[model samples]
Target: MKKEIKKIVSYSSFLALILMSVLACSSSEDSSSEEADSDDGEEAVTELHAAFAAFNSDAVTAILSDDGTEVYIETTGYPDHTSVYWETDNALYIDEPDVSKTTQDTYIGGGQGEAASFTVDATPDLTGATVATQLNTIGIAVSGASIFNDQEGAGDLDQAAGSLDWAGAHKGPGVYHYHLEPTPITSDDDSLVGILLDGVFIYGRQCNYTGGTPTDLDASGGHTSVTQYTDGVEEYHYHIINEVYAAGNYAYQPAYVLFAGPFQGY
Candidate 1:
């Protein structure tokens, strides 16, 4: 069932085109875009971005909106990988003794069962000014977990680094989320991490375009170039900056901040 859904989503361009056509005939100017609530100068997409295929098929389902101007990503928010946060009875659980569990009783799926849905513009408004990311899930990782900013509570992430597992993620009172580079998904090399709330894909430290650390990144660790998924055409995307975060007694020392953003794609 999961494989079938993934196949449909990964190759639903034809279906998306039909939907777009229908929308075009009925309402031409009412597609959502960069201005979340506005439809002016909106661009309709023909399909879901190919990068979405990198997400965990078992836990995530990405679909094009009826108007074809937005992508809806729904996830179980349960990672397919082994983690200290998983309940010991669950198959993916692992004992990371070095990691400090958030609470002896707190575990993934212990609360409301970490499920979330997000709707983002198919085409990000790059021409608009940058927008800052707020607290909570800023994006979803390919591992089917939430991607958070370098923050824990109202304070900096330094205070909670010890709680993070090998994946640089931990379960707070809410969902299990990553605060630093999720090495299980991407390390020093260039790999598709996930898509951000601003509708831009974020990659690992090294870029496939240059085969090394990008030299021309904006303040948000984003640049325009050909990623492994872009075929030959250059596209705008974000990368995990190569700089080490050097925070508290983190299990992984010299960790890279996943994303600290004033989103350029919004």
Candidate 2:
């Protein structure tokens, strides 16, 4: 009986050593991976500003420059896409066939055409407050159109829903903007839509290009995850939830905020 007890104790000790060894190795690897990821994150953030240089449209003119601290942008505030806001005589104007059936938006008319300038943090960091997005032009799409908060103007989004165009945009008396996911620039479910003034990225419906909603998102449509533009580097970003996910139970998960919900920890 004693011999058997001794054997059991020896076996247990052996198992304990193996477990400790495995845990130590795992912790070491995790630390190394985190350090490597930190380096990659820095590089990714630096190159982000350069992505906007790809924007080119006759109706819209945008220029991007980085100052090692922040990104500066200058835009003519025009969109390359078809809009009723464009005067019928202008070459870019196209009376979209479905506009009448959709939003039935009319040209309200008025306001000067002025070039706009903006600056955003080159590396947006979380603070400790939820910023109010209502009635604010939070960001600009790659197409140079303003991106408004989820709310149409100030209150419940229901009242403003009808005014949205078929592709989800309409011109104010002065400016053209989008209140939901803009369609023109989105190539697929996992494409980069735009960058917010706070320096967060906006992506299409799918969290990943391969297909699948992103996991682990916070209240503000954002999460640290791998994105196509970052070349495998994970960064904090927001995704525009497709209509299907925005409804029902899925809203409880990372899919809640349609566009990164009101600048989390602003």
Give the worst 10-residue stretch by lDDT in candidate 2.
248-257
- Write one digit per residue (lDDT tens) for candidate 1, span 174-255: 9999989998998899999998999999999999988999999999999999988878889999999999898769976778
Error of 2 at 227 (Å): 1.7
Per-residue lDDT value at 6 in model 1? 90
Local accuracy of candidate 2 as per-residue lDDT tens digits, 181-221: 66666633776767676667788767774478766666676
Candidate 2 to native Cα RMSD, angstroms: 13.7
lDDT of 2: 0.61
| Best prediction by TM-score | 1
In model 1, what is the error at residue 71, expressed in angstroms? 0.5
Clashes of each: 0, 3
Segments of candidate 1 deviating more than 4 angstroms: 1-39
The ten-residue window of minimal lDDT in model 1 covers 28-37
